[model samples]
Target: MFHRYLNKVAVVTGGSKGIGRGIVKVFVENGAKVVFCARGAAEGEALQAELNQSAAGSCSFLSCDVSQEEDIKRLIAHTVTLHGHIDCLVNNAGWHPPHKATDDTTADEFRDLLNLNLVSYFLASKYALPYLRQRHGNIINISSLVGTIGQKDAATYVATKGAILSMTKAMAVDESRYYVRVNSISPGNVMSPLWLDLAAQTGAAAEAIKAGESNQLMGRMGTEDECGLAALYLASEATFCTGVDLLLSGGAELNYGFKSQICS
Candidate 1:
């Protein structure tokens, strides 16, 4: 029902599935000519075909590993070549490694995750900022509730997310001179394939999945679709908003007591 994105050109990373997939679907439905990337060509291509089949807007998928500078450059260049300009950039590609004590994680491992989760955002922004400035476009970084409140046994993950939140603010100020808006979305717990994979890895997928609902005060985890709508708002509307970390925590960020204890 949102018509704000008609003919807009957007670039989303990790668009094959889960939160990224939801964002792609919503943007295309709203009328964006979206170019989204995933490391795997099969899934990305499949999604592109599917979305282009029925969506009001068009979709094109490119194979990319956001961690690599070359790939990031290629993505932006290819998008501009096809769309002529970028109206929005959604940095949604990232992975959450299994939780481990800081002392248990290695320097190399930490750096690797940082390259994918943190550095990629910076690189993408750097490469697209000029075009974005021209269009007065926006950037939406997909942060997490942990970035705001912190999470145990996830020092590196939390650190990267915290950096993302901070970088969003810093970049917003720097980019504002050109009228480019930058912001972030800190999701609490969206029940996506990533969460399901983690639960399965714990060998208690059913129980752990059920417990996730209770972790939120609402007795349910947030959905990818809900996260999608939030991104849509920031991307299409929210003209006056910038440098803000919008929390989509389903009240988890505000609630205290057992819900807080169990969730965190």
Candidate 2:
């Protein structure tokens, strides 16, 4: 127990599973009352129950479709109702669509994803800003390495993430006067359920994951647990940091040649 964020009021989006799940768990364990939302009521309720059972700081879950502005409004309202003030907001609800050639991707599909992956963050931020301003709290946006370096066939997703990083900086600057810090975390290959599912879709899940790990400088893909800690750091410890993207890539972006027996 790191009780760094004890008695804090935090909101997490898409917190039923994967990196969102990790963030919620870590925050609850560290004594932050968390109000998290997801689309899956079953998973959300189960997690709520689990967190309430043993957590030092309890959590509640709301069934929310974050892309909807009404849902985002209700979510922030519900959190304020429960906790009185907002101290942290983790924008973690975005999704990546399946790989498709840029030419094959329909404009409508791109717009739909853009709404989910980008506009939803905007709505959440807009709705939550007043409460956050009152508390001088912080926001952590979960972005990705693909947004910085680009990935194949994920133009729309990458674009959304890039926009998030840009928006984070803009918000940080705008909110500096109010002491509401904003930052982004760009994680590379955080192995979540979604990552495993994608791997399984490609071929043998275990082998696919291994192949992905080999590309990392550490020769292992990051875990959602690691991502959670980074979020916790931003939310709790990095008081001086704002308008920056913490690159959680396990050194994968280093300009070093790939490891090979001969090269080594």
Candidate 3:
């Protein structure tokens, strides 16, 4: 699959860990030179070394806070300087401070969610437009099932992802003239480090993972590799595909009330 991407240059935000890391790994294995950014310099640096050593793909890390416009600009600029041009952009960096009721969510938290998840995606796409147009590249945004279905106690996070879906469509339509396709991937519960951390923090790790798995028709959460494959399909194979939200939620969508059954 990656043999098709040899020598191509790609940018993936929030690439330090979790699904973002998986996406980076897939791209590099496919022969793409990658520039991945995250705010955690230590983690990013370590991952860069590991990737360089193990994968045949060339990778570099940038410690850029995606919430800031200047930082995003620097990330894109740095990628151009190192790789000469950008062939693909993956907006995968994002965070959620657990689902909370509207009354429980602070204004500051809401703003942060929008800044990091929604605005950053816009800024990255805006800055990468030129390079992407040049190569007729593609943009793949990492959204969530919450965006489409909407979730209880997750207003802010859901809103941001919902916006990404809309943005993907709008950008795709506008960029079609330049042959720069834009699409999105909406993943369901997965066993990411973040999910692991959530379990530790809430003492619900085992329970949550167990419930998510049992709820799915496949009897398990989706995998990073699964999302990676979906991303690659959109980024490379879907020439006519634009503005589509590829739902990689296993069969969770099919059995809507299964999750509630666990706690009930």
Better of 1 and 2 by TM-score: 1
Error of 1 at 163 (Å): 0.4
User: lDDT score, residue 214, model 1?
Assistant: 76
Q: Write the per-residue lDDT of candidate 3 for residues 180-239, one digit (tens) a residue.
A: 999999998877988787667767677877876875678888777777778878887888
lDDT of model 3 at position 189: 85
lDDT of 1 by residue, 1-264 (tens): 657699999999999988999999989989999999999898889989998998889999999999999999999999999999999999999989987888899999999999999999999999999999999999999989999888878899999999999999999999999999999999988888888888898888999888777778788998878888899999988999999999998788774654344654
Where in model 3 is the C-alpha error above 4 Å? 256-264
Output the lDDT of residue 24, model 1: 92
Candidate 3 lands at a TM-score of: 0.94
Clashing pairs in 1: none
The residue-by-residue lDDT of candidate 2 on 65-104, one tens digit each, is 9989999999999999998999999999988887788999
Overall lDDT per candidate, in order of appearance: 0.92, 0.91, 0.88
Quote each prediction's TM-score.
0.96, 0.95, 0.94
Ranking by lDDT: 1, 2, 3
Highest TM-score against the true fold, candidate: 1
